[model samples]
Target: MNFARTKEEQDRLEQIGELAVRFSERAGKIDEAGDFPYENMEDLKKAGYTTWTLDKEFGGKGISLYEFLLYQEKIAEGDGSTALAIGWHMGTMMDLSTRRPWNQNVWKEVVEKVKKGALINTAATEPQTGSPTRGGLPQTTAVFENGQWVINGRKTHTTLSPVLDFILVKAYIPQRKKVGIFLIPKETKGVSVEETWNTISMRGTGSHDLLLKDVRIDEKYFVETVDPVNNQSAGWLLHIPACYLGIAGAARNYALRFSTEYSPNSIEGTISDLPNIRHLIGQMELELLQARTFMYAIAEKWDRSESKVELQAALGAVKHVAVNASIRVVDAAMRIAGSKSLFFENPLQRYYRDIRAGLHNPPMDDAVIAMLAQKALDGIQN
Candidate 1:
């Protein structure tokens, strides 16, 4: 709700909002057919929105976390699946702008590729180990052979698998006893997607399994070796909550529209004038208002933060509140629409399923709670 802080920001958001409206037109079809939003992504690419987070020098808008979340939230209002699918590439690129874990020239080249509409996302989750954020060592292996690195492993949750120009694969280097990030081109030999993503939710994401069967690339593809778990918090991850918040916003819009128009002979005027419907509408707004405040406050802090460690607790807490609050908002929206919301043709049902996908995203609720508890205990001890 009016997220832009300046005139320029408002203009940018309005432009993206237009794109979101276009994407929303097909969201229902995509979700019902469980098809990838390739056309939606093409729209983003043609509009040059895909490179918004890259630095100005890299031919990008170089927006901050606050601005990125604003744009992402707007996009999700159109299509949550599309928002989530692109969020990985957008957030990863934003995070890399600061982390700079790869060789300087190599990273610059990759950014150039991104500027040219090439897409990228990290393929880290695995069937056996779960999300990489959980500190699970990747079963994927990288071996040096014939003067090149050969990678072998299957990655689950490889979002944008259908059209990712390049995949940043997390693989354990047995010889080095460390994990390395390998850049494997989608067209690389022995690389393939299994098309196994059949989840009932976020179906448009095309998050299939990325299978690498001895896919070999030169040494230059070895971007960097990193610890299995990164202690540093990432501000770009605010995109997750931002997307869910947008979904909630969409639900709120639908419920409000329904309440005002869907009047029965049993009631005077419309349901919007009814006290119980009014109560649900007010509660939904209240929930969204609280969640939005928390998300944006932390986002601004993250943008201005000088230390990652200091923002760790806030990072998790924002995601926790935003995701759970978005769920409540959608539930209330469904209630207002009554059984019609459950109809296969209703967009509300799609919103309902897509919003729940946030719960399984990174920074799970249990981990956030544990971290907050530890922070409280440490504060008391000190």
Candidate 2:
């Protein structure tokens, strides 16, 4: 089922597939307990999977965007929570390496820690301001206190909070009227994680609330200012859709297997022989094909293209198509399962819930549509 075109890609995917098998074995248990997949993450770290996206100069493989998303989708098929949680760290590393927005010394320090199996995720979303993508100024504020920067605010949706080694917090500088990202090591004074993640979806992500009350850090930790709304397109964000697509793949596989095995006395063989079931299966395949084609094509294009700015609309389109298609694929799989999909013991129920989280992830559908509309209007006027 691995559609990798090259031998190297195939070999790498096989390795991830082995790890994913182990993760899949434990997925249901972790979901039932609603706990973070710490063991799965440890496995990734031990296998060097955690630093695969780092640049080659940083003592890592520096895999291409295509390779990254390919592995991400495979991992997600095994466990959506694990894939989604780790994708943030993986994508962040890729972005930092590509952008090199940090001071050279600071970037090297981060690379060293990441090479040593450290994890990171941005704490940007606030309860009041909602998604930082909406251009809402973060309520989180940082000020110069003596020689250090003191940051104070509570950030929600801080994924991987439990085991994060560093948190890149987005905060507003009231004195300067600018927004900047500050790197706060997990053990920094006054940095605390509140156990506030109690969602019914993607429960194992450990997306708790990050509380920073007068958190102190050196001035060097003030990484860079960001114009949230005007930030350039991020190819790394494709990981979000890739994760959901993998979940959809898992649901489709489950439905296929169930169809071939489940039979009733009234039927001749298995439910899979029925025309309606075949039609549903065909539709799911088509949906996956369309999404995967769009995702991989754009990812490969990103790897070769020099202009990410021009690809902004294309990137958003990929996420929009892939995510919506994944939802449809999962929903169809549920239809194939009928009422059994609702059972707690059925993994389809879990898949249903996990995939639903995609709708709320970054690059919200509304924004993407608006962007496309603006592009079309600009095109016509030109």
Candidate 3:
């Protein structure tokens, strides 16, 4: 669908690509250490990259959804965790600023923080509630007392919590009997980040547990989005699939290089000449192209269309195809590498592990399939 529709967008992509190359150089060390890529983030901030998604009126790039996805995929090529981690902040910021769901003045202040390289994310998930996407009430509670909302709960899977200057905490308000997203500053009293992230994949994300014990915040920070339930046309979530596609691309390239350069002593030519190796490479190319087309076309469509209707099934299906295709792409690459792909030192091993993380993201496969099935049934009935 050739979505890069403007020269300004094309130039922005080039600028971000340079930063991605620098991030690529440090991705391995950050992954090996299982720590946040502080230096990589510093470089990104210094380059004025944190303002990409904010509206142009706010002195930011105001990039469209299509441009954002393209850039995110490129960053994922350098480091999937960085791309995925920052996706929450970038996507959430863009969504909030564009829609203006809550307090406008509060958001303006948040934008200033974003421009200054202050990170942010919606801390919704908890150990007991699982993903908010599944539609369970949050365990975190918000109470009004003494001119402030007292927040008391622990949130898990809070990505980039360690570096976040602001957090949109989803908490249950008993008095209102509705969910509210409280904007809590990081330096607020009783707000602390717990070191609980210990996953084998996407280790640099720092998706640790966030503790908000009696954390107090001004009531103006609470925002209630329209149609909270069934509000499913989230273009920003495309970043997740874009990330997997990038990881798959990385694996595919590594396999192609290995096949081209490695020639066994017993064989006169490299594996690139072999029919089986060529077949796997071709398969990966086809899958990647197909998945990318689906992802990018939908993102571009979201930019042009004004419909607020929830394309729940369509949204989930895109993630399903892209992520599953990505796994296959990585598998094909691993098959080509054989035993060498399993070694801890090989980049292929890292890609393999990281790509799997996509499966665990929102829009779980089973729920997606059920939604698609119901859509078909509803269509038939109509």
TM-score result, candidate 3: 0.96
Model 2 pairs in collision = none
- Name the 10 consecutive residues with the lowest summed lDDT in model 1: 225-234
| Model 2 / residue 170 / CA error / Å | 0.4
Number of clashing residue pairs in every model? 0, 0, 0
Residue pairs that clash (backbone atoms under 3 angstroms), model 1: none
Q: Write the per-residue lDDT of candidate 3 for residues 146-175, one digit (tens) a residue.
A: 888999999999999879999999888888
Candidate with more favorable, higher lDDT: 1 or 2: 2
Ranking by lDDT: 2, 1, 3
> How would you encode candidate 2's per-residue C-alpha lDDT over 161-255 as one tens digit per residue?
99999999999998899999999999998999999999889999999999999999999999999997785889999999999999999999999
lDDT of 1 by residue, 1-382 (tens): 5868999899999999999999999999999889999899999999998999888877888899999999999999999999999999999899888777888888987888999999999999999999888888999999999999999999999999999998999999999999999988889999999999898789999999999998989999999888877746888888999999999999999999999999899978999999999999999999999999889889988888787678898999999999999999999999999999999899999999999899999899999999999999999999
Q: Ten-residue segment with the worst summed lDDT in candidate 2?
A: 1-10
Q: Could you estimate the TM-score for every candidate?
A: 0.98, 0.99, 0.96
Which of the predicted structures, 1 or 3, would earn the higher TM-score when compared with the native? 1
Task: Using lDDT as the measure, name the better of candidate 1 and candidate 3.
Answer: 1
Model 1 ranges with Cα > 4 A deviation: none
